[model samples]
Target: MNQRLKTIDLARGASVFIMIIVHTLWMFATPDLQGSSLFGTVIHILGKGTASFLVAMGISMALSRRQAPWLLAKRGAQLLLLGYVMNAAKFWLPIEVFNTMPESFINAYGWQSPLNSEQLKFMLLTGDILQLAGVSLVLFAVLNIARWKTHWIATLAVAIALSSEFVRGSQFTLLPYVSDLFFANNYQVYFPVFPWISAILTGYVLGRIYQQKQKDEQYLYKVCAWLGGALLIVGAAWLAVDFKGQFGNFFHLNGGGISYLIGLNLCALALLQYLFANKSSGPITRALLYASKHVTALYVIQWVLICWLMGVFGYHTLTLWPTLYLMVLVSLLTFAVHKLYLQSKRTTIGVMQKTKRTA
Candidate 1:
């Protein structure tokens, strides 16, 4: 019910909405529709949704009161398990829809045909997002052990991000799987320790910032808003430069570059600040705040919906505007379901408390 925390919810709600749209677009539209043009750039920007989610996770961690380590591990494990269950559902579903088969259709990217069940299982085990999330959880557990000073935590996260660059290009690339603690890769794309974990650390810092300043006067809120806006502007300018190919080969993931990620964090912070300072109120903000409060449920459900859509309707060509509309519809439906789930949870908790009092 904290007004400032409403910003986090708003940010989260916006991120979730964007995520659903991006995933829906990925499922329904062709690559040509999302190529590097003006409109394509807008689509490409939507890819930042995952980064924002990860950063938000870190912020939540920072805000969390120190608790039993086992509890944290238990929650992380639960998410890891849920992620795998969703992955399995994605793999098992057939990729045909309504008899409307489009030419040039291919099997789903992660699950190709011709692989035997054993090989398929191996691929599923190794090549899914759950794998990364699982590894991240374990790594986070170890980091939590030190309960290091906040500065130390931030420093370590930065170090990890920097090291990922070297690891990406090295023979030890396979270390991510074995370590399963920090790094992960899929083809040429990488989401190793440094960049991704850095997000979590950044989140932790934001959580601290909120904890310290939630009750401060309006002037402090305004200062935080301006600071966040400045960071966003700096990040956006850097991204423009990157898109122009100004950095050339030096701008690869691990080449000591923070352009895209920094920009995203800044944008997130800016949005958070604006909402805080303005005390924004509307249906959209309310909807987002509700969604943000139940982010884990929303995240799980969205991925499930995306996989179901892709399996049921292979990536056949669709008109852009219609596809966009479909995505919006789906996002709204998904949000409704998430809200219902949250309400049910609250009801159950209340009932349990009442029963305890009676006893």
Candidate 2:
């Protein structure tokens, strides 16, 4: 039987859950919700889903390599295209077009005041996870071609992390998100591939270590736990002494914020690894693995659902009851969609196989 990495799946699962919560909050929660309450604070941290997701992507990329640059490029292109498509609702589609669109043309998401193209561009300038993933894959290919080892990647990661400080605002005139996405201007896009690339490369390092280590050696969890603890201390100290524990700045991934999250994620992963390493499939593991598997689908579909709520029901200002109901309903929808997609995919593959045999 193939060994399943519960640790990776759990992290991805957590990232997906965090994304859903954060995305929902961004769409539905009222403005000025930050740090208002414990739940709100939790939501704020989870808003760093993009960072954690990128980290997970990095690990997944390392684990799922064919060591072929062409293959990586092909997939990277596909992901980049999908990344743009995901932004269609936000930026790619002209607001006038969507505004002029008939009610019939809208899906279950209903309608709202559509944003202009430029408005949309500003929102997604840094690109999202898919684009970043494409970039990371291509970068991985480059590293492969250059015969770069994990240590080299590690060095590169540290360099980017340090460079992130210089761009915190001193280097650019544009907004942080825009400048950050296109350049090292600040933590604007929050998900730009610059400093964030380090997270993925770090994950790749962990994956490589996992791959290279003996199955019975089993010291990785210890290493991760210790590293996680150390990072937590460092990040907290930075936030306290340098940044004055400004909860706001902690969200940016370019500085102490990413350190905190990466540390938290590592600790979480270590806990998951230690606890579930021997186990195969449990309810939590299965749920997380499933979420991880269907993350892209979940992300797009959930966004559509949220948009529907925003447009049709005005869920932007959700009450507790509605929020709870929406969560349950969306989870059901995600599961159903995933199942239907898998069934359709199997049918398509089966038909192709049958045709080949007949030929």
Candidate 3:
């Protein structure tokens, strides 16, 4: 209930910041830089892994409370609305503009397909993090209220994950709006909802366990460390056995890679928890802790910024150095936006308080 949950904040905060960096690369990198297969693979792993952890932290936070179901769902709805509005604005960006951009520019940012009515429809249905997070929260909320119990919720998550592989017919293209939520098809929705939700629900289980045992610092570091290490091994073994055919699609729920990343996330989470359990933290951790406190705001801001940068301006210089420059610029801009948002919140609060007092 308190802001004392620095561990969760650190992971989510750090990941959100890393997410911005990856997105910056997607936006600013030149044709050559984007074309590098090695770069692409590394970026893909880094982005997806961090994002997975972020989502898990979100579930943990939501479940940390006994009276949180509705409140969390309300937050989820806000994210869903924001995602729809943000994605809907893409309709205004003329395809003619996109057509003028270089092919590499288009491909690098996953905007290769021509922007049209169908694209608009696809974007509308696409499950960005906000949408997925919203859906997950709402679903978790409903389940909690229904008294379905935590194990059942986790089972439902597993069902969703398995459905991605076993569910037949690529109806995502045919039924973009309808099918996009369930599985990957015509949709360019990042996060691959079904499998990702499994991660989230699993985190819910972890959170519930954590809630029960948080008072015992020994369990978090020693017992959780052993368990997390085992999971890491299983995930790694799974990846080693079938890296290409299985772990190939990092975004999609590759059954094996999910195991690997889940293990890695758990380990990272435990390590961070132990590290932050102390009173003192480094400047960087403190900064991340600050950002983690404003997760949703930072997310919405980054989305708006990415839209303006890549959707509006597209790419500027095609050189390599400029990409790094742009990434730095994006980080600076995000920090500024975070500050502005905090200021705006304070102003709104002051205005509301004044109005209340006058009444």
Candidate 4:
């Protein structure tokens, strides 16, 4: 578990690439195109692919040398704060400082160009994947503190998945943000913990097994193949019977959708491990590793870029070809900014370290 897992990183990097494509389609593509096109449909089917991040997180947590409860809880709290900060940067700053929010954007989100207090609050409190990560980590830390068995965790995950539909949109009028993190079914909440947390727990259970069988690559492959395939089959059948029931109209996936996603990720992980575990270093692998290492930073940067650029592009205004071009443009800009941010961070860290040494 101490050893770094390249396949986990690669799996996460692959999802990040998919997210870039998905977000571009979301911000730029016309609604009609998004609904009708093959490309859009495929991207939408891939969906947020955000669950992959949580799965990777669970695996990383299992692999982490430090499993202290306080450390995990502290990291979770930081992510929770960072999520809100990200909301401010991506939504509030564009509306406030840049004055760049298009009327289209305003209309789409039911916000005024001037942005009132209530609107501002809504923007700042929006729930995203980071918030989910933060909550999941804290909850996992609690489970860790209890010294729960993997089977117990797995049973808890199943219970959550089974009960998710029953409480899909339960409201917390007094604490709206709390509602978003757990069960509210609104545009503001992207990753609800009920069904989504199950994905993370599933990953945790698998991660434990994976660590135990790290050297048994064949066993890992079989587990991924058989388990993923079975889940995929069941999920596909359920979806075919009732699409809306299974998927919950995007972002709020039901149990069936969660099953398919977890299955897809497992299969993906198996494939990635097979391809890269024994291979020598290469440009593609190196790039993926970099992306994986900086996944959170990349996610934040890309979202900020997209939200800000909504001023110029307007909401859902681009045609197919133009949207494709913009996706590439946004992607390149995100990477460039991320690279600069990394370099600046490194310089600051080095300077602090040198100052400490001198002191």
Candidate 5:
């Protein structure tokens, strides 16, 4: 039997749940409905889903490589296609049905607003996880060609990070859309090669570390936990001191801010270590582990549901109290659906094995 890492799954699950809660609040929570303080704080704190998801994807990439590179490439392509399909509804479906448009007869013309082409290009280049995964797989293939040369690998990642930062605001006015896709601008279409790719490199290094370590060793977890906690503290203190007047400076630093990335990575690592130390024996841990294992399904289902809700009910009228209730319902529904999917997959695999044995 293969040994599964429950802690990783739990982390993924926690990230997914938080993503749902944040999206719900963004959709439904308002000052008039549930007051702003608590809801606002929730939104701020739970904003790391994209990072968490990317990190998890990196880890998964490392794990999946036990299979052939071609196989991994196929899987990555499938994921990319899935992402495109997921976005299709925003184009294909009636905007009015989802309340995305004002209630008017104008929507009946089947004319839709132009898709954000610039954003879509950016998604293709950087921000989309599936596309990134495919790129990472290709990178891994190249790295394999170099036979996993660590020094060269590290140098390449650092160079990319530096280049991304330096080119951050340089824009070509002639080809505005294409330039926005390649050059970092004041847009949300992130997932640029420099800093975002660094996370994957870190994951790859960590995967190598895990492989090199003795299976029975336990002290590494404690050490990582301490290191992660210390980094988190330092990052938090720096942010607190600089929070007031540093938005512009920090924005300029962008992915070049090693300290910011360190803070985020450390915090995630600390949580993972703590969970690993505790394991999943406790009820809370068990629940979290279960959630993590099915997080992908949860993510896909919840986003669609939330988008539907937003279309049907306008964002301005959403109140916090009702949003909380809706979040709980959506989370549970997502969890249940994911669990069923997993069970079905397992059953299918088992049946295939039995058929092979009989043959």
Candidate 6:
């Protein structure tokens, strides 16, 4: 079996690009532009990057030969710790230590210039995509060790997606940490495990199928295309009938919205596979593949850049022109910073290896 799928890499790279555009809009665009413009509507729909990333992660986990429970556990723990570190760097340090955030921006969010301990705690504990992935991987380690069947996993995903609406936003004050990670529906919990984990589980099931059919590449793409189409039709029809009832909130997608996202991702995957089949060596393709390889690093660098830049931009104050300009600027800076980070890491590893050899 191929160790890595080029299509998956392309999908992730595409998602990263989408994420940059959407995040830039969120951090800088004025309320009217965000809510009332055609561009905003398009960006809102393209916010599938998060779903795509989670699904791709699940697929990767299944494709990987290293299914050792201990390894998964260790990696999951690292991500969990890193999520908090990101929260501190992106939110706490700028607001509290550096005082980089403008008073207007702080007031816009109904927060004081000097955030209190409670607010700081909330920031630190905010459930982001990294936290969701970390928790999911840890849980998957248990599931894998238990030797659960693919169908069982798929059933669990369906159940979670269907029942998410009932338990969403249901918080347990005493168990703030667990609640935020798994159940909370507030702003802090952007990628709660309830419904989002379903996407990962779905990817795992599909990944298993992909493994079986990968040898027959054409057959696999055909199957995915047809299945994706059917799901898209169902999801779109439901949304057309009652969008609010089905979609609810962007972060907290209902069953119908989840179906739509899954279908959309699958279709995109099939299309990408077709496109890259014979042209994988192009400069653009290579660039995307590079971005895919360094997804976590790119995500971290971009968010840190955007969060710090918020002080200069002022939250929700920019017009369409500046917002667009900043999006391009940030994307370039992220790539530059990500390259530097990789170089530093390589140099450190080399120095450590040299020391070990001498010893």
* C-alpha TM-scores of all predictions: 0.76, 0.82, 0.82, 0.93, 0.73, 0.94
- What overall lDDT goes with each candidate model? 0.58, 0.64, 0.64, 0.82, 0.56, 0.83
**lDDT tens string, model 1, 254-274?**
312443554455565565665
Clashing pairs in 3: none
**1 against 3, candidate with superior TM-score:** 3
lDDT of 4: 0.82
Q: What is the RMSD of candidate 2?
A: 4.9
Lowest summed lDDT across 10 adjacent residues in model 5 is found at 102-111
Candidate 1: C-alpha lDDT: 0.58
Give the per-residue lDDT digits (tens) of candidate 2, residues 1-359: 03446676677776777777677766555554533656667777666555556666766776774768878778777877776676665433323433432233223234334544554455455366676777777778888788888788878876776666655543355555435553433322445665677678777776667677863225666666787688678777777766643234543455565676677777777777777756757787778888877788777666655554454445346655565566666667757777888899999999999999999
lDDT of 5 by residue, 200-257 (tens): 6655544444555753224434433554466456645655665432223322333324
Highest-scoring model, TM-score: 6
Model 1 per-residue lDDT at 307: 59
**Model 6, C-alpha of 295: deviation from truth (Å):** 0.4
TM-score of 1: 0.76
Tens digit per residue, CA lDDT, model 3, 1-359: 34245566677778777788788776666556766656645665578665345445544554455446878788778878988876655333433443333445445546665655764565566677777777776776787778766668667755765565665224666665445555663336666565677677666665666566755545644544675688679867877887874467665655566656666777777786776646567898888877777777777677657656665456634355666676677777878988987899999999999999999
Give model 2's clash tally: 4
C-alpha RMSD by candidate, in order: 5.0, 4.9, 3.8, 2.0, 5.5, 1.9
Using alpha carbons, what is the TM-score of model 2? Answer: 0.82
